[model samples]
Target: MANDPTHQFLVNKIVPIEIGGIDFSFTNASLFMVASAAVASGFLYLTTSQRGIIPSRMQSVSEMSYEFIASMLREGAGSSGMKFFPMVFSLFMFILTANLLGMMPYFFTVTSQIIVTFALALFVIGTVVLYGFYKHGFGFLKLFVPHGVPGALLPLVVTIEIISFLSRPISLSVRLFANMLAGHITLKVFAGFVASLGALGALGVGGAILPLIMTVALTGLEFLVAFLQAYVFAVLTCMYLNDAIHPGSH
Candidate 1:
């Protein structure tokens, strides 16, 4: 249906290619993911290309983004976390840009897909696990054991903590996926309302005014959500990295 809210998320294949048994087709989702990365990379590169004693507006924006991530890392994982700055920064930029781009009518929102968000979340958690084990050996198991638990309750507490730790990827992925999916679907529904109502001649246009107003309001709110979801993802990543760096701290 033309008014279906879910239609916007359909992943159409742009290039149908299969190698062996695997579908290696380039798709709308793939295109948007590439576009998101390119836009984020291009903006940062262009903004910071020229060395300036006094920063231009673009340079200032670039510098502020760098500082923002730097400060977030310092706070969340301490100075040692600086080692992962490049990865964290890239994730933040790509997610934020992808989110904002989806605000434009007809643009694909890759983050709205659970597969994409879940893959990103898995990457973050995988990094935490691999690095924690590599750096701490068996000591990384300390992350599951809180200090001062009674011997009787220790097994139960450990079980709960283990479950929570294992569920991190699902929670992280779902949070971003659900927010973007629901927000875009809601926006489309309200937009469809305006168009549908406005189609009924003079009387309907008047009714559309309320829905139109709501559509406009929701647009602004979605923009805020775009930035916030990116920040939340990055912050959680930093916290997970912190646990890896100091696994025995509780």
Candidate 2:
């Protein structure tokens, strides 16, 4: 057990089982991902199963979430983009649940791992690219060409647009993963400081108290970061989708 606290990144095979030489073994990260999916599914299922006229608490929360995302899509992507509501909604719910789940003790924060976040970001960016092509045919290539640029500068401008568009997944995935990883690492380090110093008498105890206070404050901020990161991911997805739908001016 490394005292560094970030040793949690190591994926140990809990079952230690393999099939067809493939590493399909269960690990802490895998378990957390399953838990996240189950929790999200269970929450939405229960919330929508019973629709009361006045609405139950869970139902109200669910409805509010739907409306909230719908409003965001409407504003960011416009009414035409409402077609993507379900995808956006699902993305938000999945990320939000995963984030909050990671905050629980002993639960693995899969999003802290670049592999998980990169997979998600790839899926989203891939979908946008595929849909852009499907919607516009070859004309989607026009996205790389900004309007109002002089013919002489078109190549340079197009190259820049292409690079920017191609970098979407890298930037998007990194933002979330980096935030979760850094925040958790900070919390762990502060906690270690408190533990190590509190062992010393009197003066050390007093010093430990400050780190404890900072730890609590950091925890609250982490919670907010979790939500904000999820929102940022979904919003960026919407913005990219919007660009695909209407790749007009620069």
Candidate 3:
């Protein structure tokens, strides 16, 4: 029987060890999460261990990363965005690390899972809602109704806006999950070709050679995608935060 390449991304309980009816054993997914964090921490620590007036290469990279996120917040969320800089910075770093680490062979890609992405989306949406209410009280209700809509159209417009607002988490999670899942599956299918056809097949083997080359190219592309997806995720979060902080503003 052949393994279903599409379903290969599904999570499995590797240990399945139960304690008093509760599964407490660490999973491959959990392992990857810790590994991703450790790798990110180690890399940054090693690179930035030496702080100098002139700035070492590692320190330069760290400074550059900080500037990049700070600039993004300033542009997307404005100057007041600085107040939430720590939250935004941590989010970007964790996501960027998880994504980049997942590119390694045999490493689990947690972000490729809908559950993981959904959790992230839910957190972002929840933060926006909580903060909006905290900052503006019931006035945040104004967010659902645009300022210039006619009284007759206000109800309908508010209804639609509410629905769209509720769907943000779903859309955000699905976008990331679908992209990662599709890319990884395509890579796996092409890899299967190289293994199954490249040895004993006819010119099919030569055809497989092209896919082999493509696999290498696609691997590099996936790395870029990992970073890009993280950035997209962060940017969207900033946009949502902006909307929450200043509802009805252009």
Candidate 4:
């Protein structure tokens, strides 16, 4: 049981709570989410609390992350999209911090849950839908209609676009959840093998070396993937916001 690859994801309630006959217990997932927010807020706030003639290391990190996310949003959503900078930045930091925190030993991977990713994706799509209709009214429907499509194929293209638009949340949720789930499971399995093999004998220990090496390599790769997935999620969010802003353009 010590090597159970899926055991790491078990959600044991830390604070049992019940209200209106529904379980409202706080769990490890909730804990890690709060931790992620605390870590990110601390990184941004505490790092910049001290003003210096030369930026400190923490300050530089905060500044770099700020500029990176800012540039990414601007590029994806155009200048007008700057209005949503706070929302986008918050999402990017939360996701990036959650992912990086998951890389820590015994820390929960918040994004690994379908419910969490699905909720985030729905929030994004919901924002896009509401803002699009609010800002552009019925004109937002034009997002399903691409420009310069032949008249005969227009309906089919529109239907395809609509399906794609509806599928956004599903795709976004599955992408992140699947990646984290698979990566962590693979890492756990390999690590388990390293331990198992090392315990057998001289030959087994020699074989364990390969698994140990793989575990180390995978650990580094997972960290890279954690950052990349966060970036991808944020980038897609910005692109969706762009569609909301310019629904009739494409």
Tell me each candidate's TM-score. Answer: 0.98, 0.94, 0.91, 0.98
Worst 10-residue lDDT window for candidate 3 reads 1-10
lDDT of 4 by residue, 5-84 (tens): 99988998999999999988999999999999999998899999987669999899998888988899899999999898
lDDT of each: 0.96, 0.87, 0.82, 0.93
Q: Candidate 1 lDDT, tens digit per residue, 1-250? A: 9899999999999999899989989999999999999999999999888878799999999999999999999999999999999989999999999999989898999999999999999999999999999999999999999999999999999999999999999999999999999999999999999999999999999999998999999999999999999999999999999999999887
Candidate 4: Cα lDDT at 56: 98
Q: Candidate 4, after superposition: displacement of residue 101 in Å?
A: 1.0
**Residue clash pairs of candidate 4:** none
- Native-to-model Cα distance after best TM-score fit, residue 93 in candidate 1, in Å: 0.4
> Alpha-carbon error at 141 in model 2, in Å?
1.1
Candidates in descending TM-score order: 1, 4, 2, 3
Candidate 2 lDDT, 1-250, residue by residue in tens: 5448787566877877689998888988888888988998899889889878888999999889889899999888889999989899988888888888988766788899998889999988888888888989888888898778999999999899999998999999999999999988898888888988998988999999999999999999999998999999999988988887876734
Give the local distance difference test score of model 4.
0.93
Greater-TM-score candidate between 3 and 4: 4
Residues 1-250 of candidate 3: C-alpha lDDT, one tens digit per residue:
2435666565667677789998777778887778877877787778777767788877898788888889998888899877777777777777788888777876778888898899999998999899989999987877887888899998899899999999999998898888788878878887887877777678778778888998998898888888888888888888888877887674
Q: State which candidate, 2 or 4, has the greater lDDT.
A: 4
Q: For candidate 1, what is the TM-score?
A: 0.98
Worst ten in a row by lDDT for model 2: 1-10
Error of 3 at 79 (Å): 1.5
The segments of candidate 2 whose C-alpha lies over 4 angstroms from its true place after superposition are: none
